[model samples]
Target chain A: MSYCVNCGVELDRTAACCALCGTEVCNPSQPVDMTAPKPFPEEMQPPPPNNRPLIAGLLAALLSLPVLVCLVTNLVFGGGAWSVYPIGGIVLFWVLTAGPLLSRKPRPVPLIALDAFAVLVYLFVIAALGGQGLIVGLHWYLRLALPIVVVVAAATLFPVAYLRRYRADGLVTSAILFVDAGLALVGIELALSFFAGHPFQLSWSWIVLISCLAMSVALLIIDRSPHLLAELRRRLHV
Target chain B: MSPLRKKSRPATAYAEWFKLDNAAKLYPAIHTGKRASMFRISAVLAEPVRPELLQAALEEVLPRFPAYAVRLHSGLFWHYFGHAPGCPRVLPDIKNPMLRPRFREKPGFLFRVFHYERRIAVEFFHALADASGVLVFLKTLVAAYLARAGGPGVAPGRLPETVYGPGLLDPAATPDPEEFEDAFLRYAHLHGPQGYREPKAYHFASTPEPIHTLHMVLGLVPVDRLLEAARRRKVTITEYLAAVYVDTLLEMQRREREVLHVDPRRRPLPVRLQVPVNLRRFFPTKSLRNFSFFVNVSIDAANGDYAFDEILPLVHHRMRLGLDKRTLAASIGQNVKPERSLALRLTPLFLKNLAIAEIYRRVGEPTSSGAMSNLGEVEMPPELADAVERFEFSLGPSFRIRTNVAMASYKGTLAITFSSTCKETDLERGFLTRLVRDGIPVKVESNR
Candidate 1:
């Protein structure tokens, strides 16, 4: 029942190597299971890790911490204002773009869509309830909220669809991620100054929101297909 | 449990780009964040002939090798614990009138730190220390020092001991202050590598992955036959092999695209290759640390569909022209000055690498397609045959780039082997197969 992972030649139980190509056969139940994994002998590799699940879980928790903190802060200090709802927006961003959710796996579209939907709902709730607390008008919400909504929606949903269909991936290279993160951080800093109680308010949260949106979308597209990234790395031929 | 530490942290605009660029600049990062597997090649020499004897004769080994010597001047000799030899410390001074320009207003650090044993190391720091200009030259100084430490003049005979490295670096050893970092290449604004950019190719937090290596021995015809073959080709053997590699690469690039359904337009990895050229061809130096400049030739993926034969001559031509005897001679005779200042030269290496790192972003992740170093012919007296059965060569990558080719001939046979620290093995198999197809029989001896 075993077949070559490469070339797909059917294998025999006792075969030490591919009868046709001489590639060592990896059939375990067969008498010649010993021929498996040759060429790349196991002794040459580093020790394998034992705690993959723990590692993944930890990474996921670490990524979501910022979102958790934002929620806590909003309920306590956000004064029941729709403005505080961006905390939900922030959390939504992480759920979609960060952690295990963002790692390489088969069919990431649906999973990503769910996170984006959650974030969108949270943002919508915040926008819908904006004027009730903590210094606000619908105009501020209109400008910032719409952008947040558009970006979050695009980042959350677009990449999933794009990746499912397989297209326009290089747009999310690590370089783009770097640029996005940097600009978003600065935007957040700048937004604080234009609104809120302090010289700068969470209005700057929009910067991170945008970065999160961009990064989420970009990573999804890249994950969908890394043809461009792989080509670049291969040419460097390092 | 506490959350795992994240190496990829969000950064502010300018800082983040700079950080990532610095990461890209490092040869190791360029190798995909892989750890460097250490290589130690040892060749035992004849018993304790006077150290000075071998050192004295080193200059005669090759016309292109650097020459310079180190002396403690007695009182200036520094020392560490239970010293069998070497100073606790000694400064590395500029030697060989040929190196006057490479030296700065202040004497270099190499002049200060003396080796603890008879060993004279030629080391290239893995971006953790001095800039390449200083480190490589220092090693050249060490090569020259080998000649000096051996003595005034070594008559033609076998070296008494082994002269190879993987020599221990005693972390606890104390030292005096003299430094490396060549005094060349002015980092100015309005030009690329603009205004004092640092050379420290930084990797934020991801530790390098473990590297795996397997050695192979392929016996071949003697150096004489290889030389004969080269002469027949009307090209240096180095050129011949380089052609083979270039051709093989072009083939592989084509196959990868077709098989993977990849776009054929873009070159796989857009890289700038650095080929070290001995400056000794330009200037006469009695010093071994000649401080050579690497000539870079990038593979143009845009020119992908082309055949190797078509491109081979162009590469051969460039390397030959770059190494032209008369050209280097003329530059050397010009008495050019060292490029940078002492303190200023060392500063960028420590602060942060901006341009060297942003290579991928600015030039499009321009990675080095590994490196090709044809040490060419390393001829010793024919009498040293039994002690040195066929010779071999291996080149180490600087910081960002891994994987390199080193070819040398000792016996009458011409043998070649490709070395890679990476896991993928297609490049090696493909290279060997093509050479065999070209009529050179490949007898792969399984060491395992």
Candidate 2:
């Protein structure tokens, strides 16, 4: 006897809410008939279970095989901590490939940060094993590699954070990405110049920065103006 | 003899097998858990359905449908069918009717029978049968159940002769050989050219429901009101409804442009519908295997905004032209010619699967915005009709198209069911509200 006030169609007596709009029934004249049989049964079919964790576990076991062989060879042969390089490389690869699969809901920020940390550790292992003094290796690592990795991670994480915080449109996303790229290039150049003992000055990075800025501005303009956006879409459609 | 005891028959008793028909060849390659090529037909009786009786009825009537009695088997070049070993257990119906059948699992059957309250439904994988064939199977199954249940004042043996009408066949009779033949291969003229391509169609961009969850909304309308509305428009019910669907889609596209600001480049894509035509009407064939083809009727949104009136004739004429025997046969030839090619026949099943999947991606899924299938009015003998309250038909989820419509009318009520995987109900609301405005009363039901 009750009808959805929103859709104006008679609702089935068994329905507590309108199927189309999900509007709750609130008719005072007639209450929902709880005893009426539903159109469908109550049993629900569950979806197929997730297989990512099992795959990740298998990958972990497969990856450990090479690591084990390298360790055994290092132990049998009288090598001086040489296995650290190969072992570090394998660990880094595993983290990059299988890390996301381990978690049910992957948070991009932490995963990317972990990946950056792995790369830094692998590079440090290589530098430490360079036969150079530990002091020298540590010096270069802090001066050059650390800053570069930090810059790349920042470049990736900034856009992701912005996207997650405010679900931006495609044009806005592209604009933010362009700006992030420009800044990352500047940071990389500064780290390189400082490492080589040259004065911090913009070189080819200026061209990339200028180009990215111009593209970002143009995209923003198109995004703001409907007519221009429509025109661009028509011409550039796939 | 109890049909359940008949299950102990020797394996030799059910040895017949079949090839995947021309129209059926595409389903096994393209179907996925999310997008199963499945459909359902259900009949609600006046009284609660007894599970034990329904199960026995299925066993008795299933022998009459040899095409539906087998399990899918893979061969070198194509997937075929072999006789399934045991009777498929009748399960309690789920809120979501048709979950894609995992053929490797137990009961390896292509179809399932389910009972919920008064309703007895059968869900079929498209490779088994089209809606027309499934309807016949369902009708016979229900008839058998009724005979066993024996309603008041009715005796099983003394049932009227009229009870076995065109739809309900005798379960004791042997199945006609013509019933399982591939009608497409028989009717196709191989001289026709290969497939024709159309511009890509517009698709709704909406969030999808979780896997295995399908949202169905049924709008029940009086058949007389719908027929009268179609008559006023000088078109058949199918034509009128399709035009309305196209118009609704066009309006949704317009709203997307004005409100959501969709990229204008997509404006050129047409709002096309794939309306499945039962070829049995065009060419006389008793073959129950897949003998149906779809006609793509569309309106280009870039041309201009179209009123409902303008869309009607365009859809009507396009349907008439597409349903012609020559056009349909040519389309059938386009599909069947590949099966006949010596090189293709020699190719491994794995390679053919890849090629077919790619072709469907390029030429099939993109060509239609959505699909609408009208099973037309279902006719049952008076005895069964009075016992059965209503009948419903619904299409399963599609790979690309988010929403699809299926219409089946029985006894004076027409049930227009929209099966969708999208989270948004805007399309269903727009469609049903439009009908309500046109003076047809609709009572809404759902498995939300």
Candidate 3:
């Protein structure tokens, strides 16, 4: 029997080198077993076909159909370039869905920013179809839709970014949710009032906002008082 | 000879489809490209395998395993097997066998055939069948090939069949199919816990190897010496090996703690080995589909240090208790009960997949330090057995299990093959060296 001189572990009679340490054995008295059975195949097979290109081709084919149909309809009907609506819609939809699927690793910030841009462009198409000039379209997109999407996206992205760095307990997460909901509601009202050409006036949003604030305070109090939290958990059987 | 002539017709001539057997339903739901649940069972022949002959043997044997020929089709509430288009090709053996996504290449076929030099191997997605199920298929294929190659007293017309019964060959056997039925669902009851659950155990962390590069270390030893050692310990070979494995992990843990100067008051995680039990032994059925579950044997280090002797009895007793019929049925019930739930059944396929994958991630590998599947003795007809050199079993890397062992004995050699996705060789080295210290000679091999 042959043994690995370096590690002192028993070596297969056929091994030229130690399987564990890769030290070549040079024994004149006991030659290596040259014809031992190999455990794995030496030759590697051709890699499997990469289907990314196929997926891209299929997506392109499916996405083009709607734009082509809409472009044809607009030309035939001669109705104020209405084709832009479906064209923009299709492009916007692809950005939101297929864009992430096409990538090996997707960073959420860039993808979400692209989605927000797509929404603005789609709205711009509507504004242009309304016979508004570039100035009016820009005004509505910049003043209304852009601000609302930004707040909504921030509401999502900030929490995700925070949670990614550190885990939050259930109570902390619920508290954040309640406060974020109230802030989002307030932001929506401000943006709408700006569009209506009215001063910052709180209406039904105040009542909902107050309720959200109260919920957040209650959750905080329960978090601080462990006994109350335990009692609640028992009652809810959570 | 009488049986061969009486029922020699193709098994598939009767049906082109089948249902995913009881133990196979969960695989289709959670399987992915990276974490594909697949296992490989291979046989080494006395002569180099000819590609054409292996292909011919596959063509002959493919019709016999009709259950393995179908492709997976997702239904609203469940997944079913449908007939694949053409025959699965017998390809050249690849470096990595089981981890590659075979279903994507051959959309419906659940198993693949590969030949490398003198070795002929088949890798089956866990959805296809357990190791026991695949072994019979592989043995039959090898038998047919040897017969065609002109083995003594063996004829190509009569391939060696499983001892399960003659219902395998009859074309009318499909009328009362029992093997393809999900035995788990058939015998599921709420008598015990649905599945084994435990607190997450410690994982062996390491510098991750390159993607798709799994390191394998194989140790070959005489079956007699190991059996004698087990006899001395008054435990089975599996129990003995598991004890050695747990002891190795404990040693590693103690070393890590000593180096880091960690407090003794801190609770050390339990070291558990997930032993897959072949339900076929407890339940009677001839079906070759997946009919197995796992019994987790654990040693909690929080109490105190355990010697090798202490761990062996603990593993033996735990294994006996875990194999209880009612307990196994309850475990089966745990899995099937979820499938039977109205809420889960009504959930959309995509949602169900998400839920299942999440649960598997949390509860699957973290609960076990490693898995050791003992395929037991491999037997073949005397004529065909003479033409075979050895048999090996390999399980692909799991999401959390970085290292695992698969063992099978043929002739006088017991092959213990370790499939690992990590760079460290501590666990394998420790286990083998302990055997050597105990006076069992080991001949180590590797696929570096």
Candidate 4:
């Protein structure tokens, strides 16, 4: 056996250098052994669970149980066909929470639109069950809830689309958000007024519109002029 | 799975499907199309490779390795392996070969076999197997090719041949059940005491080259000279090489400290090396799957500066302690315990993947300065061995750890190949130069 000159420990025949230090072995009297078996094993082998897939498929099945229970309870306990509302609500909830998990690449825009569509469908079902029928109930639902939900979706979606397409910074994104809020508020007021059979007059919307306009103008200035924006940011601790 | 056909093969051609082993579960969870945990083991022959014969050999030898005939599949709680529909096709090697082989790109295969001039390369996604397993596959493929192409001496019984003929690869040979076992789980004590904790280790810093382009530095060292060097050092070759790596890392840290003008009071980070222990050595299993775990062999720079001589014995001791059966079992228990937890078992695959990736970032590379996977010596039957010139093993570049060193010896040549995604070559240069300084003969080759 050859001893390590540096550490005074015995070396393995297959060793090329000291395991402890970075010292190389050099021995004239003791030659390196080449015929010994290596310390490691040479052979290799083929190196479990069905319940997993069943559980995933069961997720849809399990989630549907709550909707089923609510439907039966509403129809049995109550006189009117009010079960449609809770059933629609549960279905909409599932679409929002679990639908994205199914997709390879779930973006925000399409998912948000899907959420809005689910809510609209739910409202139409409620109108049809609680009101006259699909014909007259849907007419009222389209006039009121459809316009309101569409405007709300547009308000959330428009800014997202703009920000994504332009790759906007915080200042630009905030400005767009503020401007869209004002427009959505105006749209809500217009839809309510027209459905309510009253003249469209901006009341709560006016205050929101002015404040949003001011914030949008300030953000636009900050985005365009870097110097004043830095000063304002420092002074306001923003 | 599409019912419609494109280039569909006959149903009988597909091989048996198998599940990913316990150690392999992490790879499939974390692998993306761009960043996969993969490695390559290649054999360079004395003569240039013929693509047609190599393809035929691949076809011949594939039936012998039923475990490798798999593709990734999504299950409810975990990802799994399913039998791919067709046989893997051999192709001419690409310019840069270790880029993640997407399941779609390879048309459902998890591994690729490539031939370029004199070299035959097998690149595997870690989900398929480890370095040792790849070496076996490469040797068997090469052996089969030589017999068919009339190139060299054919070792009749040594090659994997079917009962019917030489062209059919082990058609009747049943896959050993032990080959597919999770040796870690089988050997580990369910309630065993946990292993030691790892202190944050020093990491080499460098500006990375372009993504997916790992620079390979292959140092061809004569086995005789290296064996002599280790003998004089009075340590195993693995221990000696690990010490050299630690020394090089320490030097780099000192330079960084001087350049950055860092405070002297700040404790020096530990220089730790993650040395993989093949579980097959400890457990009586012949698994060709991932059956290995690494122990962090370290030098505590916090204890103060360590001279090369001082660090040598410490590394030798650490390696011994780290490889002890109980120590390995305890470490394996720690990993397997988490895997077997009821909470973790119940978790959905996607969410578990996210959690696993985060845990790896926090606990994986931080515990080690670098990884040194010594595949030791690859011994083939004398007749097949005579035709092969060299064998090379390389760990693919990792995101957190920029450089990983892998070495395999064949035909009296120890080819230590270092793969790094970083632009810096300081560690490799320093280590090789140290060997040369110690009178060990080393010839270097690089793909920069």
Give the runs in model 4 whose Cα sits over 4 Å from its true position: A1-238, B1-17, B104-106, B154-172
DockQ of each: 0.05, 0.60, 0.40, 0.03
**C-alpha lDDT of all candidate models, in order:** 0.40, 0.85, 0.76, 0.75
What TM-score between 0 and 1 does chain B of candidate 4 receive?
0.91
Model 2: per-residue Cα lDDT over B171-195, one tens digit each: 8887776777777877876676666
Q: Which candidate tops DockQ?
A: 2
Q: Is candidate 1 or candidate 4 better by DockQ?
A: 1
What is the Å distance of residue B97 in model 2 from its true position?
2.4
Better of 3 and 4 by lDDT: 3
lDDT: worst 10-residue window of model 1 chain A = A39-48
Writing each residue's lDDT as its tens digit, candidate 4 over B307-399 gives: 888888998998999888876777677777787789988999899999988777767777889999999888766656667888888888776
lDDT of 4: 0.75
Prediction RMSDs, each to the true structure: 16.1, 7.2, 6.0, 15.5
TM-score of chain A of 4: 0.69
Task: State how far residue B400 of model 4 sits from its true place (Å).
Answer: 0.9
Per-residue lDDT of model 1, residues B44-138, tens digit only: 22222233433333333211211112211111111101111222223121110001111112221112221212323232222222222233333
What are the fnat scores of the candidates, in the order listed? 0.02, 0.88, 0.55, 0.00
How many clashes in each structure?
58, 0, 4, 25
Docking class of 1: incorrect
Ranking by DockQ: 2, 3, 1, 4
Compute the lDDT of residue A150 as modeled in candidate 1: 45
